[model samples]
Target: MTTKRCTMPFLRACAALAGVALIAGCASAPEGAAPKNSNGWVKDEVSDSYVFAYPLVLMDVSREAATGNAPGQAASNTLRNAQSLPPVGASSPPEPNLDTLVSTGWLDLGNEPVLISLPDTHGRYMDARALDMWTNVLWSTATPANERVNGLKAQTIAFVPAGWKGTLPARVKRIDVSTRYAWFIARIQTRGGADLNAVRRLQRGLRVAPLAAWDAHGKRAAQAEAQSGAGLSGDPVETGAPAARVAALDANGYFNRLALALEDNAPVPDDQHALKILGDIGVHPGDGAQLPSGSKDMAMVNAGLADGRTRVATPPSNLLAGNGWLWIGDDAGNYGPDYSLRAYAAWASPGLPTSRDEVRARVAQDSDGHALNGANRYVIHFSAKQLPPVRGFWSITAYTTDGALDGDAPVRIAFGDRNGARRNRDGSIDVHVSAERARGGSNWVPAPKGDFRLVLRMYAPKPQATDGSWQPAAVERQ
Candidate 1:
């Protein structure tokens, strides 16, 4: 017979009845005293609790980094638009998209609602989304649940606090957000370097402002010119990227940050039990300023930290894996009870859009399930009947195992419909992958001379692609 897993509600009830004294002892006991719980139990709880809090902590640190340290017009309620595509081989952001230019900003809803104004895309492909501090997608143009009439249409939106009643412009739609902080990201299609100017024009048309100023009609000269990045106050977070900085934080630093973040980004109902368990280890919200000082307790904390990092680095079971490929879909961007999957997604792609907007699949092995090496030539043959199905488009990009484009590659690092890859007479497409140019470079995707991987992205994918009714062909050694 299978054993049932211990549910959080049961754990909470047990803690209330018998574990309260033990928890108080754990919290107030001297560092050198024997641990209130067994070493293994403490280690497991610490790791699990850390994973539960990872997304919020990461999101908070990322906001500080982006709004304070990033260049351009990055600031609270102001956008930092990318003037060009990410440089080839840039490793700062893993798996950068080559199809669109990005614009990002943060919102502060503690005082008032923020207004976002968007211009029409005129049939061009564009997507925008807003995520709460817990990394839950509060609103997305591409998510069917949002009921956006036209994701690319000219529109205005007001992101208001959960209980705030406000008067917005007659045409502005109001979206209630539960957190005091939110993140907004927008992407506009760009064909290539030559097409950047057009995308920039659209980017310039986007605007963000405070709802009060907008209602007053003056708009404070557009919120004092939208609080130019130059006027940004406060010392930025440490110099490194947010993810790296978060990883480097110590036990006290990390847990304290989480405690402070919870003041604004309150936990959802499902997180109550997890929060209670965290208190047993003295990790209560607003009270994680100090960690246990005993050597034995510190060792358990450190081990738990290392274990949590490893668990998040490993792929979660929810990913759709097949034919040597792994991917995520509709389940991403809105995880409710799956904290492991949520942390994994946040670590993998901090600003990932909903699967309805895009689906990304990666493969590091060939048809034989061997690690892909650039020394061997390969081909991904898509039969005419099996071509990727998408409403927007699809592309396959080659990257080093470390997730960087090959700097030494002579030909393009990616190939797809946009490249107008040559097709066979049977209407099938054969995408050649090799270190050397293949078939005179027609539909050729260059690879590094060592280990490599491939990423397949389908934007606005059709139902078949996400439902597993359709799958990309395996990569065969040539």
Candidate 2:
């Protein structure tokens, strides 16, 4: 197989956002640069920082608005799929049904609280939590448990299964305490004699409901993020200090500004800004009425989200500032699954030179229900001269389909330039990932029972590396 490798020094140079040289390397203004604009007045430290930060803030906000739908869920976007466990063999035992128990189902209690019901798959609903290909969580059991299923009487309730097909006590429902942004999937055991359809129905019925609408156009969002260059998805312009001050001001007062700026709907009134409505989120005078028999944690989260929505008609200034910063800063959190196989800690961004199609992709699954088949191996690839673009450190690791240490991993190791990984006569590094051991495998990491993933980590990276000017090479199967 043809594998493109990256070198260390090249990657190192890429770290500092050296790409700026590719644009224009004008030196910073000497100690006293000309005034920023028509105002001709020098900006104070805070104001200057904010002034330089405004375009970045706008960039960040626009990019965030884009994630409402992006390649994150696309089949060709393999970065996320790799993080989950692939299915086990056909004869593998039932691990978990992602569509059920852990689907993040949500139901509005309306202005008031509501009671929710779930079926027991086994005595235990969820045995272990496995991240799905979508980075969604799935719960599985080996044998079903049938203990006290007191779902209602308790303030916090959830079904904990012993194993697959374990029975649940006659009437047990988990009640969770209240909180905002709380997510829980109560596992329920299924009876042995029950038909497969019944179990399937249980799986189908489970889900997160009454949620925010899914963001529809991910590509468009990504495009916007790419142009800004500041946040995980934007362009960074060279504004002077005044811009930085604007960002600080936005942060200091407009925590909710981002929420507003990135709104899928029309612009909000400045006086009725998003921050004005966000200040009261998750705050309660106190729990006046106690939930005697219900899921306390679940209820708390539900109420908190609701309260934030109702009390705060606008958003918070701090959140707004954060949003602005994120938009232009070119920083975004990696939320989707990574298959734990990212050979390095480094991640792929939307704006890399490599086509999204060439990076990563996923398949249906393994018996374990995680994603193992990577349409492209080494989701992030670099060559001998193009090692990771980092300021500090870099390494690549292998992960089993379940995101656990691969029991079958060769030497159970990760490879990195710092670790003495032998280089080829041509000066390229070979990182082998598979179920079998590579002869003299210096960087062999174990693969779990099912599919696996790889990660490449770059600690303390330079701007170009994180900003997506330099892209990693792809992994080729031997």
Candidate 3:
């Protein structure tokens, strides 16, 4: 009989060969590959996946930052009130409006429904906007269709999670929220420093709490609890500020967080195609995603992230453009299934955006096609018949090129109907835009000492303003 020997080296070599073959088989591209120069199906899939997940990722990071454990920080079920307006040149929230005092809070609906109570505004302009995890406005008092009492009557609102069953007070309006977490922001109009006390009183009147807590302690006790900084529990997520958290995340971290968020906050039915695309790449709600291991797969995902970032920063063709001004269309806040548009809005402005009737127009250049700088004077002339059509009011405000309030501008940086602008003999209004104070007081909108832009706000705008029939006057250099 022949002696058969199995050497250690031969056994090791066989195992190594088998491993290589298995890896090669797993990495092989699918059949029917794309032609040359085309971003193959893998890259396309990666691109679509990033776009589909950007908003959710962004919101998750923001929620973690806002509710995480920290000193002087309110927990998920409490309110945090901003007693005064944001400082000039506050980059945290670009283009901070001087018109209102804002109070913000995060809601946790996992346990039970929450109650929101608003005091009578006495004809003052006040709004409470609640956003879901995806940044969609779940409910807003600013929307005419949803307004509770026209700023004249006290109101109570109960926010319940999907499939929640309970009997609510007949007087309390119920709003259904899809996600377990919700963000609330209340804005009360402030005339100036002199009117701050009144606004503070109004802010104090805004209350939020769990339905059971509110029912047990009552509205006054709930408000006192929120103010005392009590009853806030520790947050489970560990994260920093929203922007910092996003920057710290790698491809794996970002995708993992997105997967987890999707598990909690299910996507709308319209997003089935996107969900399928994600599944093909081993990413599914409630399942820990397994990313492809090949170098080419990593490269495609990184490239897709870059592409999505660019798309969000660039305005789409549907934006309203006229005389160097650009603004979103009538579909400002209520985005149904337009992922790109929704992602862009979340990236640019994180809070609940104003509705179509509240138009916000921006201008970056003068009529002569030059970048707007404080070195030169400019004028925006609106004929009597061409004035912005708005039932509420109109105003023009200036900000730095990066969207911060121009700190160099005077305290009264904005001017419009509230300023009681002076009109010329022909009934045309000439708005002076310059670093130096203009001759006329009411029609002057202060500009920064360097490059700046203008935002024209028209609240309760008419059809002409929204339908693109009425265009803002050109900014002509003097």
Maximum-TM-score candidate: 1
**Model 3 lDDT, full chain set:** 0.69
TM-score, one value per model: 0.86, 0.29, 0.84
lDDT of 1: 0.73
- Of 1 and 2, the candidate ranking higher by TM-score: 1
For candidate 3, what's the RMSD?
14.5
Residue pairs that clash (backbone atoms under 3 angstroms), model 3: none
Residue-pair clashes per prediction, in order, are 0, 175, 0
Ranking 1 against 2 by lDDT, winner: 1
Error of 1 at 110 (Å): 1.5
Candidate rank order under TM-score: 1, 3, 2
lDDT of 2 by residue, 207-251 (tens): 222211112321112222111111111011111222223234323
Ranking of all predicted structures according to lDDT, beginning with the best and ending with the worst: 1, 3, 2
Candidate 1 lDDT over 22-64, as tens digits, reads 2223345434444555565556566776787888999999887
Tell me how far the alpha carbon of residue 10 in candidate 1 is from the true structure, in angstroms, after superposition: 22
Task: Assess the local accuracy of residue 156 in candidate 3 as a C-alpha lDDT between 0 and 100.
Answer: 81
Q: Which of candidates 1 and 3 reaches a greater TM-score?
A: 1
Candidate with more favorable, higher TM-score: 2 or 3: 3
